[model samples]
Target: MEIIAPGDKFFHDIPEKIINDTRYMSYFKDCIGVIDGTHVDARIPVEEQAAYIGRYHSLTQNVIAACDFNMCFTFVSPGWEGSAHAVRIFKHAVMDPKYNFPAPPPVDAGYPLQRGYLRPYLGTRYHIPDFRRGHINAE
Candidate 1:
């Protein structure tokens, strides 16, 4: 904890910046950042290989990570079994008081329901590339 400074200052500071950014405000208005799980190849004893082999049939270790739009990693949880589900990892991280993961959006908003967590309203323009294209000439 001393190395990471797991406190309000360390956790809330970046969220504030993300909340204020125009490009990220609307779609992920209530979100601090995005969390995702990745897989990295690993080697283990053949007897234990089944536990490490992932859905893709490759030996892997699951790594869950959180990052902001700037691509800065704020949190990382690694070394889970490859078979471990991402949602399970996420739930554990948020529920554990040690991490103090950011609060999720209001439940009524119906987040994480098939929209890749949060989706822009239908017909609404989103994505940084779209923003860049529309504002290419703007100062």
Candidate 2:
């Protein structure tokens, strides 16, 4: 835990990647890190395999992790069943004090908008190509 601490102290400064990139400097000036989840193969007893079998029909564990722009891991929450939804794991990480997830700044309104974090609305199509062409389709 000493090597991996999660708080503003460890991420107070804007990353160099964003600072150097004019396109993201102004927009993501305060951004700290990126969070995501993925499924990794897991080994378990035969009797417990069913619970781990996910969409890929293989035993796996869902892992939630976060990393700064420099590619350093800031937080990692692993061991969730592969069948578990990403939202379920993410909510637990945020609600559980033990995780000590860093809090982001506040936003006025939107889905998944918490005191310091925000996520894109689920089920909304967000193709960058479409956006680049100004053809965003309302969901």
Candidate 3:
């Protein structure tokens, strides 16, 4: 709410702002986001501890997450068991059909699949922050 302000438009476009953000581009090249998990130190409810308890570490219930270049939550896997491995958690939580966020739209005739990734002749843009200068470039 604080960042979105009182009445910011939903479809605000700011692609030109990041077209050549060298630092942000260099830091995040070939990476859409960095993913990780951290334990939140809270004892599970006594009744729920049976499932939440980790076999090895046995002390924490974790909040798994994926953070983008701006630290926005692209994905979050909360209430997960304390012992879930990164890959297992990522595979299930991020791509599970239950998750609300939509996956990337499938490519059609214009962009052929290459090396198991989509390559397009052109692309659309979005209103994203420019971290190169540590400020928002709205235009």
Candidate 4:
């Protein structure tokens, strides 16, 4: 609660910084970042284990974040879980009037669904990847 500065509280220029930086994972262009679930040890009471025990072994929180090729975190949802999804946290962080990133084209649009872009299948929409790759005919 006390570590984050007011400006760094949520999404910001971090995503754009990752998109432009070429020093890290060069495979991506216009890609904002990637995230994965990891487990960590906890000291909480046994009653709390049910909520924390993640996919494989022990207690954990589902962390969803976007990091640049340089391993710098651009956007991060620190404490999240199976009850919620990564896309939901990212969307929540950005939609707050503070971030002001361009809202994605409405979900009803045709290109995303047809190309299998950010559908429920590809996982959450937080993947700031350069999805434009190999997308010449998508228009």
Query: Which one is best on TM-score?
Result: 2
Error of 2 at 120 (Å): 3.3
Candidate 1: residue pairs that collide: none
Off by over 4 Å in 4: 1-28, 82-88, 91-139
Q: Point out the higher-scoring one by TM-score: 2 or 3.
A: 2
Best by lDDT: 2
> What TM-score would every model get versus the actual structure?
0.59, 0.76, 0.49, 0.43
Q: Is candidate 2 or candidate 4 better by lDDT?
A: 2
Worst 10 residues of 2 by lDDT: 107-116
lDDT of 2 by residue, 60-139 (tens): 99998888787888888889999998888888887898888765555454325555565776755564444667654665
Error of 1 at 86 (Å): 0.7
Residues 52-114, candidate 4: write the lDDT tens digits. Answer: 666555666766555444576555556655334545655565558664433332333222233
Backbone clashes in model 4, listed as residue pairs: 24-69, 25-69, 31-129, 31-130, 32-128
Task: Provide the lDDT at 11 for model 1.
Answer: 37
Report lDDT (Cα) of residue 48, candidate 1.
Answer: 86
**Which one wins by lDDT: 1 or 3?**
1
**Which pairs of residues have clashing backbones in candidate 2?**
104-116
lDDT of 1 by residue, 1-139 (tens): 4222223433334465667888866655555566677889998888988888898899999998877655666678887889998877877876698875555444344334432246346655454446766644432
Off by over 4 Å in 2: 1-3, 6-11, 109-111, 121-139
- Whole-model lDDT values for every prediction: 0.66, 0.76, 0.48, 0.46
**Candidates 1 and 2: which is better by lDDT?**
2
